[model samples]
Target: MLRVLAVDDEKPLLEELLYLLRSDDRVLSAEGACDATGALRRITRALESGPDGADAIDVVFLDIHMAGLTGLDVARLLAGFAHPPLVVFVTAHEGFAVQAFDLKAVDYVLKPVRPERLAEAVRRASDHLGRSAAQRPPGAAGPPGPPAVPLAGPARHRPAPDTGAAPAAGSAAAAAADRAQDLIAVELGGVTRFVAIADIAYVEAQGDYARLHTDAASHLVRIPLSTLEERWAPRGFVRIHRRHLVALRRIDELRIDAGTTSVRIGAAELQVSRRHARQLRDLLMRQATG
Candidate 1:
């Protein structure tokens, strides 16, 4: 079970986050902090009072746009904590995805949260915690340390590595590549594989996961469509409907039939939601010019 802290300056949003997290079967406790100060204080108190030095917070669902200190600011402070909780930024803005990922956030969820989407974030956080536990040395002296910082910015394409020589750890290029990976990891037949974002024709939401459609196959990943929309929008993926996101480059044709807007990507014809149709067309026009 996971113990979580929900932080947001807005009272209603904080309440919503808490409610949603608490409703999950995986969550043991869900608490809210109206600001960064309160969150830090709670974390300090929890750490100080926990039995045998265990962390009280397993994950933090934070809001990016806050009054006193933004979620990013809070995250930076968490970097200094001895046992920093997994941070999941729940924000309306999509532009912050790069920075959030750079900060090593477990996941970035969009505003007007969906139950399935929120649940997916929780799963990601759980996976993160499990990985952390597996990597930690047995009976370590102090609390588990903060997460490692992720490299900033999109990576430029580089040639494949040679089997004979391995690149040194923390190489600038390697870090950049890690940060800028256009590929998303997906589990296929009990094996992990990387699916290139460019090759993805479209993405469809599937409860707590997403179906990544490519030319030859589709892989179901434990990431929500909203999360992918925020992360990949800057990379030519655009939301065409509530349940679907299409890659601008893979969209071979757009159709408006009987006042209904739709797009074609590799024989898959997906209807664009009324609200997102105009935006999709505008994006298509922009792509046409660029």
Candidate 2:
């Protein structure tokens, strides 16, 4: 679990960001500051209390454009600290990405924040924390520290290393979130493999776990079915039934027989619940016509 601070001058955006961060099981706590000054004050308090303290912030989701001191300024000031909270710049503009990286920001997120995008940022932050935690000597002193050096320049685009510290609970849906949002991590036999998101045809819920089905086989992961639904919604995975989530692009045909709704993906036919029938049909129709 990680402690997070979200800074955005817009009240609605700040509230929404806070809600999303707090909703994540990965987060220990989430707080907000409307501007750079307030964010700095809160950060100062947390730092003064010590890094291991209850109020310590592990990551800061900052808006790049602000009235007085911008998020970039804060990041620069943070770099001067012997220990600094990780910075993730949020902006509507793509122009500042280079500058943000130059300031050592771990991730850069664009405006009208998407849940999956923010989730990816959180995963990177978690990996940094995990890797740092693993490197620290046992029972060694002062607060769980930030990365010795932040990921910046082209290095920021590189995938995170396996921290080997019992990783994030997201399955195929979130595994892709670990880095580039293109591949999902799955453990098969005794070895872990990265599965392409484009290869997953559907996901089936099995108790507390989800099984990712591809062309050849299935892989089970510990993450919940609901978690995958939320994160993969943007990727075209939709709830066809309470027990099934199918990829829109993978659907071979939609079938309707005597008021029953079902979909065919390859040779497998899965029933679509009445509640999700309309939405699934709408999405599929759009996928077809658009």
Candidate 3:
């Protein structure tokens, strides 16, 4: 049985979500909150009281654009909870889909939420919880507690494109591969070879395709730079230009010559666009501080 909490500022939408969740046989109980604060309070009480607690919520159907604290804000807070509930963002807006995935949301359902879509989200959450329980350390009462605060770790998510099917939530290896493609398969002289993602210095876009640059050699693949950017950003790959994405760890130094900024990665110096310069600097600062 899955416990769910549906949070939204709109009373009618909140009610509709609660009703839909209750209709599902897998859902043990469903509750609603008018704001992030109320939702957080309920989650805190549940965690303090353990699984048998009255207000326990296994999954949260969060609304992205709430009145006070937005759904993202709420999720940021939950990331640190001792027992964080799986999140499933419900939104009419699609723009937050990438961020939702970055937060490791169980699912993202576009609003006016359909019963079928909501049910699918519940199934994924159940699968995830089951996997977590199975993988717990021997003799442990439960899975390890989450961070005391949301750590600024690298992103762990696949590309934002929908595949018409949810990924298998039971496989931890699958989740890891989604975040970082450890071995990139590329064709060299008509022979396919794998390159370690850690060895790649940077990626440069070549028309419809992108080329991965390593210390010794470069590999060109059919993947688009934008797609790689979306997938690898969490893995410390930052888009420094419209056509270039550089691995943060590979950057030797940032150089400013005649007011133009560029990053030196191995033997290559990739220029940074004005729009991405500040963001790159901030990311570097965060990485350094953390």
Residue lDDT tens for model 3, 138-173: 666553343221112223447768868856767657
TM-score per prediction, in order, is 0.48, 0.49, 0.49
Candidate-wise lDDT, in order: 0.77, 0.80, 0.78
Segments in model 3 whose C-alpha atoms lie over 4 Å from true places: 142-290
Residue 196 in candidate 2 has what lDDT?
74
For model 1, how does the per-residue alpha-carbon lDDT over 1-290 read when each residue is reduced to its tens digit?
Answer: 89888988789988988888989999988989876656766666555554234556778899987643367877876766577778999999999999999999999999899999999999999988888777878865365443332111122468877777666776868877965586788887899888778778889999989998888998999888899999987887888888998777777556666778777776788988999987876665444322
In Å, residue 264's CA in model 1 sits off its true spot by 55
Model 1 ranges off by over 4 Å: 50-55, 144-290
Clash-forming residue pairs, model 1: 155-180
- Which ten contiguous residues of candidate 2 have the minimum total lDDT? 147-156
Leading candidate by lDDT: 2
Please estimate how well model 2 matches the true structure, expressed as its whole-model Cα lDDT: 0.80
Q: What overall lDDT, based on C-alpha atoms, would model 3 receive against the true structure?
A: 0.78
